[model samples]
Target: MKLHALSPLERQDLIKQYAKSFSERAKQHDEEQSFPFENIEELKMIGYTSLSLPKTLGGQGIPLTEWLKLQELIATADGSTSLSIGWHMGIVSELNQKNWPDSVLTHVTKKISQNGFLLNTAATEPDTGSPTRGGKPTTQAKKVGSDWVLSGRKSFTSMVPALDFILVSASMDDDQVGYFLIEKGASGVRVEETWNTIAMRGTASHDLILENVKIPHDHLVELVVPGKKSPSGWLLHIPACYLGIAQAAQTEAVSFASTYSPNSLPGPIKDIPAVQSKIGENEADLIQARYLLYGVSAKWDAATDEERLEMQSELGVAKYHVVNAAQKIVDRAMRVVGAQSLFTSNPLQRYYRDVRAGLHNPPMDDRTLVLLAQSLFN
Candidate 1:
């Protein structure tokens, strides 16, 4: 369909078509706690996986606002799949804009375009906590003859089942933290099925066990100054996913209210003043959060590199507002649906669990608040 040539709205319509089927299958995946590999494959078939690459590199090079909108649409169908693939999308988008070597960028983007390859960074560990908190990795990487051998375990390695590449963070012999790009099927690399949370279970975010996995020296992609990461506007996809989930909850609640008639009621509960008020509040919250998210995204897409560096706090602020609003929206939706929303058959239950996962994603709420405070002082 030459998706890259389509207008943003046209492309979104195409995604909506695909997402309808995804919405149908979401229940099965959630019930089985199974990863949605088929959904990922379908997205690949339509070239959605490579949409975030630079236009000069044979991709759409979609703007941040448009990219996040597509992500939200996908999340409205299935939050776990939306989140699993969003990491690949946002990481590819972010790295392509960085100062990584030209050859490396070309190689990575080529695989994405040609093979539907996926990549994600594995940084979290039981001892070190969230990578954003600046804990040094206990995972050790030692210099072998012409390669680096990494041996350690990484927690919360999302999309591990389908990942073609994993950028692992390891502490080097020199006490430096290096991100090594390790290919799947590398010697001694194994996945331990440790992800069993009540939320986002379909992400397959298992423990990645690396036992002396060796990669070429050039594959040590980047070194980090502990506790420091450039502000990532691409992280807005996290909020976008939750917003979709919230919207899904809203839809479910409204539909349920409109049709659910009890012996005690004159008609569907949707006509009740209290139910209408809850629906109104949900809509208002969605409007507020969407404006903030898209507004920040538009500003980001139009900003130059130097200007974007100063937008870190603004980006975090958007995330904070959007995620918390999503949580509230879901809660209100459950109230609108009454006890039925908690039933295993209800999608709202899944939405409730999935939205909670957003709070634990990068750029925690506390950190966002601290950044806002420090910005005023500065």
Candidate 2:
């Protein structure tokens, strides 16, 4: 059945079914440090990858809140898969909402619908750090005849293995940042296996090495003044991923507590007051985080462009509180499980490492504080 024809609840149930299947292989993927290529294929087969595209482009046109729910389910199964695909979903949604050239937007979306192509931005670098921090990209783009040639190395190019097109940011001669769309496997474009992080190992967030990669003149999709762009509500996917991991952690802890009776105990630890307290705490934190996350996301869906421009602070605050709460919940879950939570075989250990990576995502805690402080002054 077509995804758009299904009710929201039905669509969500379909996704949950797939997420359960993903969970079965999540441990193997994490342990082997291998990307879940089959998962992406399944998502495509079920039309999950194109759910965020505009309905005019033959997509589900899922609103922000519903889209985040899908992401959260995937993350609960495997953070690496969720994060890797989240970039693709968010970028597509953002571009479709923006005033990008219709030609470029139509072309890309068409490719996504027809060929199951994927897209993501390659923005981070070794020296400049996150593009959100306002450091100009050292990667340069020059007018070479009828086309532009780009040369730079981008770090943390997530999902490069499966991406069909990469949106690369480059410093133009005019002192503005230009985002160019380059197809994968272009001459001089290679992925370096540089991702060796302790968490989210299956994301394949390696280094993208571009040595004089050339693209058509029209491929320079957008030119923006660095640090002057509007807020992207689509970034809520980052927090949603963490929230899913947190929820998974809580579930695992509770399951363990509900069983595993010790010789000194009359029954499972879940009946113990101390363990119950931890479970209650996790539930409380998740309730608050879920409310804030879903509330802001719904507001974004109903907001006008001008109104959204004013929501930067609220967006950052949601991300800040939710991600931090996710970390806290994961920590408490581990405590409930005791030393066994740290065992390599335990999924709680994977959840612990995966949730920590959220702090390093965009709109970090320090940046969120600054946004809050500036809001008060305004």
Give me the runs in candidate 1 sitting further than 4 Å from their true place: 101-103
lDDT per residue (tens digit) for residues 1-378 in model 2 = 545567889988888888887898888988888889989988887777788887787566789899899899899988989999999988887665656678887888898877778999999999899888888999999999999999999999999899999999999998889899999789989999999988999999999999999888889988876666688988999999999999999999889999879999999998999999999999999999999999999999999989999899888989999999999999999999999999998999999999999999988899889878877798
Q: lDDT (0-100) at residue 50 of candidate 2?
A: 82
* Model 1 Cα lDDT, one tens digit per residue, 1-378: 746668899999999999998999999998888999999998988888888877776677889899899999999999998999999988888665556567776787789888889989999999999999999999999999998899999999999999998989999988899888888899999999998899998999999999988888788888897689888888999999999999999999889999999989989999899999999999999999999999999999999999999899889989999999999999999999988888999999999999999999989999999988987898
- Backbone clashes in model 2: 0
Model 1, global lDDT: 0.91
RMSD (Cα, Å) for all candidates, in order, is: 1.2, 1.2
Off by over 4 Å in 2: none
lDDT of 1 at 328: 96
Model 2, position 330, has a per-residue lDDT of 96
